[model samples]
Target: MFHRYLNKVAVVTGGSKGIGRGIVKVFVENGAKVVFCARGAAEGEALQAELNQSAAGSCSFLSCDVSQEEDIKRLIAHTVTLHGHIDCLVNNAGWHPPHKATDDTTADEFRDLLNLNLVSYFLASKYALPYLRQRHGNIINISSLVGTIGQKDAATYVATKGAILSMTKAMAVDESRYYVRVNSISPGNVMSPLWLDLAAQTGAAAEAIKAGESNQLMGRMGTEDECGLAALYLASEATFCTGVDLLLSGGAELNYGFKSQICS
Candidate 1:
């Protein structure tokens, strides 16, 4: 127990599973009352129950479709109702669509994803800003390495993430006067359920994951647990940091040649 964020009021989006799940768990364990939302009521309720059972700081879950502005409004309202003030907001609800050639991707599909992956963050931020301003709290946006370096066939997703990083900086600057810090975390290959599912879709899940790990400088893909800690750091410890993207890539972006027996 790191009780760094004890008695804090935090909101997490898409917190039923994967990196969102990790963030919620870590925050609850560290004594932050968390109000998290997801689309899956079953998973959300189960997690709520689990967190309430043993957590030092309890959590509640709301069934929310974050892309909807009404849902985002209700979510922030519900959190304020429960906790009185907002101290942290983790924008973690975005999704990546399946790989498709840029030419094959329909404009409508791109717009739909853009709404989910980008506009939803905007709505959440807009709705939550007043409460956050009152508390001088912080926001952590979960972005990705693909947004910085680009990935194949994920133009729309990458674009959304890039926009998030840009928006984070803009918000940080705008909110500096109010002491509401904003930052982004760009994680590379955080192995979540979604990552495993994608791997399984490609071929043998275990082998696919291994192949992905080999590309990392550490020769292992990051875990959602690691991502959670980074979020916790931003939310709790990095008081001086704002308008920056913490690159959680396990050194994968280093300009070093790939490891090979001969090269080594």
Candidate 2:
């Protein structure tokens, strides 16, 4: 176990599974005390027990629905109470709904996505900034590659992610005075449970998976561990980085036209 984050405290949202879980594990393995939350108590508690037993750092879990403002507020308060200060706030909670065309999407659906994907980040940052400023800590927002590069029939999801990138830059500018850095990660296609579930929704999971793999220049999907390592870099090592959108696309956006069949 590394001691880079030996005495730090980090709070990760939606940390029971997928990318959030990966981030939590990375932080704990690096020796940072972590307070992670998820709506499912079973998974959250199980992860807490498993990590505390095997990881170099300690971890605790809480039941939280990031869609609600009260839950975010409570989460921040509880973390400060337990750890006295927050060294990092990782906003990793959010959903990517099934593809839907603009004509089929409704106002309520858009608002709901905004509340879950965008507003929650804002609320968490707002509540955690005071403690973060005190510790000169940073905020790592989990955005998506599709936010910059458009996706098919996923306007709402894309909108939220794009907004997150913009918001991260604005927050960085405003929070610079406090010495609190703010940055974001835009992952292209990571092989997580959430990604698989979305792929299955297409009715041809295997084909969708293949296409996803082909979309990246590496001819494969990224792993949760990769995302975790990127977050670790931003939080611990990239001292000069702020308002930067670190793209984890595996060269997916390099050359236009069509994916190189030769490489595949």
Candidate 3:
């Protein structure tokens, strides 16, 4: 029902599935000519075909590993070549490694995750900022509730997310001179394939999945679709908003007591 994105050109990373997939679907439905990337060509291509089949807007998928500078450059260049300009950039590609004590994680491992989760955002922004400035476009970084409140046994993950939140603010100020808006979305717990994979890895997928609902005060985890709508708002509307970390925590960020204890 949102018509704000008609003919807009957007670039989303990790668009094959889960939160990224939801964002792609919503943007295309709203009328964006979206170019989204995933490391795997099969899934990305499949999604592109599917979305282009029925969506009001068009979709094109490119194979990319956001961690690599070359790939990031290629993505932006290819998008501009096809769309002529970028109206929005959604940095949604990232992975959450299994939780481990800081002392248990290695320097190399930490750096690797940082390259994918943190550095990629910076690189993408750097490469697209000029075009974005021209269009007065926006950037939406997909942060997490942990970035705001912190999470145990996830020092590196939390650190990267915290950096993302901070970088969003810093970049917003720097980019504002050109009228480019930058912001972030800190999701609490969206029940996506990533969460399901983690639960399965714990060998208690059913129980752990059920417990996730209770972790939120609402007795349910947030959905990818809900996260999608939030991104849509920031991307299409929210003209006056910038440098803000919008929390989509389903009240988890505000609630205290057992819900807080169990969730965190």
Question: Which structure among the candidates has the greatest lDDT?
Answer: 2
Q: Could you tell me how far off, in angstroms, the CA of residue 214 lies in candidate 3 after the best superposition? A: 1.1
Supply the TM-score for candidate 2: 0.96
Model 3, span 102-154: residue lDDT tens:
88999999999999999999999999999999999999999899998888788
Q: All candidates' lDDT scores?
A: 0.91, 0.93, 0.92
lDDT of 2 by residue, 1-264 (tens): 456788799999999998899899888999999999999999999999999998889999999999989999999999999999999999999999999999999999999999999999999999999999999999999999999988888999999999999999999999999999999999999988899999999999999999999988899998888888899999999999999999999988888755344753
Cα error of candidate 2 at position 50, Å: 1.0
lDDT of 3: 0.92
Report the alpha-carbon TM-score of model 3 versus the true structure: 0.96
Ordered by TM-score, highest first, the candidates read 2, 3, 1
Q: Estimated TM-score per prediction?
A: 0.95, 0.96, 0.96
Clashing pairs in 1: none
Scored against the true structure, residue 228 in model 3 reaches a CA lDDT of 80
Task: List residue ranges in candidate 3 displaced over 4 A.
Answer: 258-264
Which digits, one per residue and each the tens of the lDDT, describe model 1 over residues 88-143? 99999988887788999999998999899889988899889999999999999999
